[model samples]
Target: MKKDRITTINKTAETIETDLLVYFAVEAKGKMPECDTAVHSQVKKAFELKDFSGKAAEQILFYPPARSKIAAARVLVLGTGPVNKEKDKGAALDMLREVGGEVAKVCASVKARDVVVCLPPPKHLSPALTDPEISAGALAEGIILGDYRFEKYKESTRKKTDYPGLDEIKFVCKDNLKIVHQGVEKAKNAAFAACTARDMANEPGNHWTSADFAAYAKQLAADTGLGYRCLEKKEMEQMGMGGILAVNQGSYVPARMVVLEYLPENRTETILLVGKGLTFDSGGISIKPSAGMEEMKYDMCGGAAVMCAMQAVALEKPDVGVVAIVPATDNMSGSRALHPGDIISHYNGVTSEVVNTDAEGRLILADALAWGIEHFKPACVLDAATLTGAVIIGLGHHYTGLVSNNNALAKAVEAAGSLAGEPVWRLPLNKNYEKQIESDVADIKNTGGKPAGTITAAAYLSKFVGKTPWAHLDIAGTAWEFTKKAYIPKGPSGTATRTFINLVRNWKPGKIK
Candidate 1:
């Protein structure tokens, strides 16, 4: 992890000890913050020249003369657009995050190692968000996320600059020391969990295998006091998990089911998180096109998210009992690989006629969902998977496809996704779609048809959920992509880790009635 050392300081940026100083200046209205005469002169000169108006996404870079009173050499002023609306609250808060990411990109380009960020009190902003904690948290998220660079495969990271990427980031939040620390701590924990997920997702399929996932689960359990178990190929076969066995028959790496549980004393509700753990999806005998086949390593992002979410749950120690199940394997097209129209009898005796070998995520997920519900009897089940490209066609990259059986659970899932900056748009779960997956010789078909493909995929998983209030988050569109947008690099986004963590942390029982 190339993350910077994050700290909170009550002192102003001018007097802070760092290589660069960062400031927040609102668009068209922000007054220059109190600083030394030289810094003041620089700001005034920029305002006079009109070269650096405080517009949204705008930045002004200045270098103070040598031997100045301020300890910083370079100063970066970030622009925040007008933020006054109550309804656009999410957008406003996100602007702060955007500004933080912008500053981080600048610092990364310059290869600066340390910097001090000063959050100026914007007079035009609402008073409710004037609290130091909220702003500090948002900025920390951007700085940490933007500073990310998955350069592990690079031969050398050594550069000509004095330092590489950021090593330290000090946030000056004045007298609000306690709240600022609290916010920064929370952000740091969330970022740590999410970035860990990203790292796992970005790993090549060969490097991060089913056994590797089991190892990570054991480490997490050991570190966080969570109960962990790894059901190897023998155990899974003994338990009659046909879906997992069928998928792994093509791979030499073997299959494993990683189960992580965080139980608190006298917990009222249990929530099960099932993630599809296909480390690599080659579409089995029904092979995908050779193009873009390398990117199939991201097929395990769902498992990565669940693994990281369980880790976060352990750290937060939420009152609700949380159990995460990831049935991991690599789907390859060897001679013995599963062929089209194969019948897979899942853990719960639900047989699926696999029309397309590429639709393997739901097959593995069915086993975990069935086992998780029956063995744990969780109050609710939320299974996330990069299930289908139809979801990407429908929701694009901005939103995840959410389908659920119960209205109350659906509402809660949507709220959790929204709070975590991973919003989900609800799709219908009516019984009407169930018929699309009806099979001739099996209990159901792996895929329904071309029309409403996302809904039909959820319909197939719904069969194994039993009586639990279940929600399916098809994160196919949002998990990993090559697009470079703002703070998000061209790789895995750690899609649902924070949302799952938020759901567990804020979960309250008996409210669904």
Candidate 2:
């Protein structure tokens, strides 16, 4: 994974000599917002000719003539739409992130090695955008996220678009140098963690296995001063984690449970993050159709997001305790694959009848959630997984489906998601939904019928969480091919990485009751 070095300079965009100078502006009364007078006439002319409308995400590019006031050879303008005074800070940050993504995309297309981005002055911004530090961080995140490319396996000669990517990105701000630098640092750590998750999710199943996840977690712990431990098949079996053992019966590769912890000195509460690590889902005996089966390699995206988020947690050193548990395995339909009607007991002693092997994500997650909650005794628990296709039907790829037992915890997670540019929609968790997972032969079943499938899956996990303030995010839709945004690529959106980071970064002990 190659990342651009992001920096901030207390200087004007006109004075920066670079491959490109990018400016973001909002439309107002069909006139350009405050900009350098040197290029004011040129910009005004473009608006007059209707070459640029300055609509949201609209863009225009032109070269500066020799001896132009701006030092850059080329200039690009990106539109962020009309400002809304009623919009909150979250909306402002979201818009800036989109603008930042646009800047990176333009730079990459033109092979601009070094680029300078001019942050929109607060006076011309929405009322919510008054905070320069928050605005700068959001913009930086967009640049890092938009610049991601996963070409590790491509042959050097056969690779496409091999131009050296953005080598350096500089944010031009005239004042508040210290605050702006701090914002850039926050973006660098959180966004870099998100890219790390993208790289993991892009790897083919043959290259990345359950062991690879454990190995990565172990190394991340060593480098980041985190406490790490992993449970192999032997340990899981000893602990009677039947859900995991049952799922791994068909695969030669053993299952692993990777745990990483960040315990800050002034921690107020402990948050447990459980992620499903099904490396490749072949649907076991209830095998899925051959169509798009190759994409099952992304089944572990939830795990990638959780483990990689820990990297950001370590970097930021938030004043809260975080424990990440990923139960890793591959669900394959080998000769010994799990059979329908099989009853497996989880770590918490609750039994689940295996009705559909394709619904294996919940099985592994059940064990991890129960085990983590039992051992860690966290104040709150949040689990993310590509758990169900029903979530896609309900919310599509634009939002993550959230079901929670506690309102305060759910709202906290939703607020964090909103600020991170990952919107979460909460679905009603009714007692009626629990009836869908009830089993005649066991305590419960692995899946409910197709009706409200996403909710029932959450209902099943809810049994394991007991009274803990818990939230389950069905990220099946948003994990990949997420709504077409400039920063989010075609595959593996790295959906929950930043959401988890922000959840920890802004955590308040008194908020969760």
Candidate 3:
């Protein structure tokens, strides 16, 4: 993907020099928001002609000749429809993201290298972000997110854009200049981190192994000044992380448990983020069907999200203490590969029966969670994984499946998901489902059959979190290949990265604050 230039400026559309100048038009109750008089006269003329309607995602490109008195060669007008009418603040924000995405695609179609975006007039904005700074920030996030692309492998064959990346993205906002600038910076950083996660997920498994995860984490640690460590097979054996080791027995490469830590200057409360890092899950000894096994490369999406999020947290330098753990390895069918019915003890000393090797995500996460709690003693533990197909069955392609031990933590996660435009649904963790994972021989069984599969998997990981407030995000549906949206590509949605980052940035460290 091309790296773009994003700038927040206190300049007008006609004042900026660019290949294309874009303006936002807000329509409510069939009326358009106030526009710059210079552009307004033209837009009014178009509306009167019935040639252009100010509807959401609507656009029109105009070639204002040299005598047009416009600094830009072309001008584009985008419509954000009736956003002010939405009763729910959450829904309004989501619509704004989509609007931003549409604007980016419009620029792409026109081959606009240097672009300018004017913030919507205050009269048309939703009350949720009444502050101009907040509103401008949301729009900035949309523009950057909309510019995302993943064609690294095909770079040699792909046609180039007019510019390698966006020549300039200048935002013209009239109020709270400093806050708007800050918002743009934050959004750019977050979007860059999310795109990084997408790049990791989009790579083929052969290129992105446990070793690759370690190198990436170490490089991030070195660049950001975070503490990084990779515990190899011998160290894991000594530490007794049987769950991670058992699943890796079938692969040619050794297992690694990667740990990254960020210690902020302010007085601290520890927060642990654990991710399942199965690089390519071939389902091991049990094996998966021949069809669509190619998509297994995305098995490590949870780990990718955590790694990139840590990069962002390090750059943002949040006030709370944060730790990230990724237990990385591939699940394959080798002579030494683990078999169903095999028993393995976890880092927390809980022995589990491996009923199905494909259910390996929870196993690696179990070890990381147990180890993280022991070493970090974090106040809150949050882990995400593409764990079960049942989540897609339960929530379909729209939401992540959430299971939490604490009400406050659950509520916080849900709120964060809402703000990030990645929504989630809470699942019941009643003790009745716990019985599904109960084992006759071992302390617990890995597979709970098909019933409540997502919940039972969360229950299995719940055993290792101890008493710390914990939440599990099952992103089986949102991670990839569900459907294509205007902004997000069809593969590797980078599903929970933003929500996790939002939680860390807004968190109080104690009480899930």
Candidate 4:
């Protein structure tokens, strides 16, 4: 495991030795965040002189006076606009997350290797942000996430200098020491998982294939004591998972269904996770325009999220059982690539007619979803995939398109997403949308024409989940190039990875209620 970049300390801000001292300020008039009395007067003077206002994302960096008791060389104040509104806690918490990113960027700009952040007292903010544990988690998540850079393949001389060469970050929290440490650990685990997903997503198609996914999962299982297995192409063939094999027909690399399981002692219930792992999508024989096909390397972000989420679950040791399956393959335009009007059978024997080869994500996901449900008999099933471009058109990259067969499961997932700052908007899933996928030649068609494309894709996946409560996150829009936030980088947001971690950590048996 990589060394942790953040930790918590019981020391006060005024006594801690660090290159930078960080504080978050809110917009309330004459109200300031918890800080040293000397530093408070300085910030108060700045506010009086109109040098700073606590509007969201605002920051003021100044060196502490030589006479002041503050031990840090410099102090940075970040603005979080009016967090008192009780109506939107999710947005309020995200303000802290955004500020965390801002601090990381500042650390990089000034080359501050050691930093200490002073978390605001519970009395000065909204109920949601007032909880020290939740706020600490959000801040920790922001710092690591915003500081991430995928320069693995770049030469050292050409690498970006803006990368945060952070050595350590200590959180100054007024809450109980043990509680704050738990919060920091939670955030550390979640952020690391998200970054792992980002690393996989940023890998070039040729570098990250179905075999790479299997290898990564296999090693992760060995290191974390999780059960691991990968079904090779021949194994998939014998099992008659035609959907996955059909999608892999074009690639030189063989397909694999990578599975990781965490069955804790006295497990209450089981949840199955499925991700679409298209290592690359060239639209197969149908072919996509060359304009932006390079981004096709991100087509497997769903698989990255699921595989990395298991890393968090393993470390946290959540009591609930988790079973994750990723069907890995690349869709290329080889001579043997899948063609339009091709018919394939899924693991459950459901036949699908391929109307468009570009819609191959659903093809591979169908087999994994069916196989996971049949074998694990999980209480609920959730799947995430960058499955449709229509989702981009519908949600416009700000929201993940959620389609679920059960309302109870959908609400739970939505709440978890909100807390994770990877918000998901639930879309309708009924016979009205299901009818669009109905096919005359086969049980269902892969594409439901152009209208309601995202829904139709979910509708296609719905067939394989059977009656088990299921939710599908169409992260097509949110997986990468997500809404501009200081914490979310330009490529591969690692969106649903945190949401999955939060969901699994907070799982309660019979949570459908």
Best lDDT among the predictions, by candidate number: 2
TM-score for candidate 1, residues paired by index? 0.94
lDDT of all the models against the reference? Answer: 0.81, 0.88, 0.83, 0.87
Cα lDDT of model 4 by residue, 102-197, tens digit: 988898888888889887776656776666788778888888887788767767667455453678888987667787788889989999899999
What is the number of backbone collisions in each predicted candidate, taken in the order shown? Answer: 0, 0, 1, 0
Off by over 4 Å in 4: 1-5, 30-35, 65-68, 156-164
**Pairs of colliding residues, candidate 3:** 508-513
Q: Rank the candidates by lDDT, best first.
A: 2, 4, 3, 1
TM-score of each: 0.94, 0.96, 0.96, 0.96
Of candidate 2, the 10-residue stretch with the lowest lDDT total is 33-42
How would you encode candidate 3's per-residue C-alpha lDDT over 330-386 as one tens digit per residue? 999999999999999998889999999999999999999988898888888999899
Q: Which is the winner by lDDT between candidate 1 and candidate 3?
A: 3
Q: Candidate 1 on 1-513: residue-level lDDT in tens? A: 343468887875677667788876555455543333435566567767876656766676777767766778788876665554544444555556667778888897666788888766645444445666666776787788777777667557655543346778888866678998877877777777888889998899878999999999998898889999988888888888999899888989989999999878889988999998999999998888999989899999999999998866887777899999999999998778888889989999888898998999998998899988999988899998999999999989988899998899888887777656678999997778999999998989898889999999999998998678999999989998623456677789998888898788678897554
Better of 1 and 3 by TM-score: 3
**TM-score, cand. 3 vs. native:** 0.96
